[model samples]
Target: MTAIQLESASAQSKHEATLPELGLVCITVSQEVRFRTITRTRYLQFDQKERKKALKSIYEDNLQRLNSALTFCEKHSIKLYRMTSNLFPLCDIEDRIGENLLESMSADLAKIGERAAKLGIRMVLHPDQFVVLSSEKPQVVENSINILQTHARIMDMLGLPRSSWALMNIHGGKSGRGKELIEVISQLPENIKSRLTLENDENAYSTSELLEVCQNAGIPLVFDAHHHICHEKLDSYDDESVTEMFYAARETWDNPDYQLVHISNGKDAFKDRKHSDLITDMPSCYREAPWIEVEAKTKEEAIAHLRDWWEGET
Candidate 1:
């Protein structure tokens, strides 16, 4: 087997001396999976046999990609390995775990959690975009809460601690604003709260605004570099103002237990979310953060960039 080599991002700064774990967005792999799915569509597309075959192939291919990347990291002596929901969901292993559709994902996750423990890999699941906590027509927010609570139940069923291998990445909903955001989180059981993390988003609130809400509610805050920039500038704030907003949130939310964060290249023009190549230009402030996940347009490129950035080679 070829050893996957990873580039180190440590030379750039002392804070990065202990390189934060790195991961690809995996959503980029969507094209590969979708392409194969389309090809398999013509043959037994929805039939149980066909669905099983296609899903199996997708899982194998994705694991191949991850294993290859992990091999690369091993060869280079890199320490971080981050996998987001973007890649895992493509496997559609939801049916393997839990009870109904709501509980379906837990079994798959329990197996994944065990694997992560054995492999020393960190597994983080991004909240599905559709999951939300709002009193709107669709009631996505309530449904999302139910989904998470069920996930909590599933974890318990598997004998996993709430803080075990998996982590839930989430964003506050804009439907009900601040008060509603508090209500959504407050309703969750304490066990669920420990597993749930709130990330900063561009449209909903600035890091400062989110910190204010989470601080009072006792929910941990996640800072997305790009989302902070988009939010500040969307309302006409300049680059300097955006920078100020990001650091401000960092200062307010920084704590020992809630230390993990998301970092990605985002554009000022938010007409469509186009992952920016300027990730190399990440503000100097984030170099010291203990955990940062790199989300890019594609996994291959993200893997390469993170390696380069990690070693200060970029």
Candidate 2:
């Protein structure tokens, strides 16, 4: 099989004449997002001193990292770029509670989206760790859906074209309660639902499981390599089993829209699910998947590691 899985011609023709480039998820530059220490807490609470420090400090950051990556892409002649944002908090009750961050975020997103468009790049927002549809608490699930609704509005206001520029990366919930998740999705506005895409989680579902859902929901899927490896449901001890899992994910999506995939590395022991630097070295799976975003631990090192793989001598 080819390194990357490909989609059908009909689906490929829907996107712009240009193809999507391999994307890197960024969380490093904004230390507050990745390093959940006192600094982040202070910043999140609107502590002036800490905010000033974070704003002024210019050490390995998301903004600088994005600039460096764009320059690297320019040097390498990469046509399109993809990025993952950790800015879902604006929709969270805690983050936006008694605050107007939602409006501010919407305004800022437009500018950011415009800039990304100018740079021939697209940004996607991946649901954070706490955002889950499988939560037993009805409130938590409601909050997650509320966040999705906010995301759809943000994308709409930012002039993002449907099926491009912005996408919601969701994981299939465990507990075999995906039917509840589907009901929530079904309740979304048609336009918003159009932008919804489901991805296979590490354990909750397999590629086949995700495909089955997509077949019924009429949506797409983003396959995560590391998640697939760490999946408790998938027996990864044997090489043949691994190969079978990979093939199953690859064959799950007959449509091009389902082609996008996430690539990352994890410990074979499945302890800390950190994104390792060995992503590019692994054989590519979501071939012809229009987009591939790296879910690394830190945004800065993520790009650094990706460049090492993309331009490095094999």
215-255: candidate 2 lDDT, tens digit per residue: 66666666665666666443342345544555555554444
lDDT of 1 by residue, 1-314 (tens): 10111011121322435655555443344343221233323533466665555566654455455555445545544334554343333232344411333244445544544443444444455667766664454466656776676556644543344542245767776633777777667877776876677777767666777777777677666677667766655532235655565555555443432256676665455423567543545655565555567666665466567667667743
TM agreement with the true structure for every prediction: 0.66, 0.66
In TM-score terms, candidate 1 sits at: 0.66
Clashing residue pairs in all predictions, respectively, total: 14, 9
Q: Candidate 1 — which residues are off by over 4 angstroms?
A: 1-17, 27-111, 153-160, 234-258, 267-272
User: What are the RMSD figures for all models against the true structure?
Assistant: 7.0, 7.1
* lDDT of every predicted structure (CA atoms): 0.54, 0.54
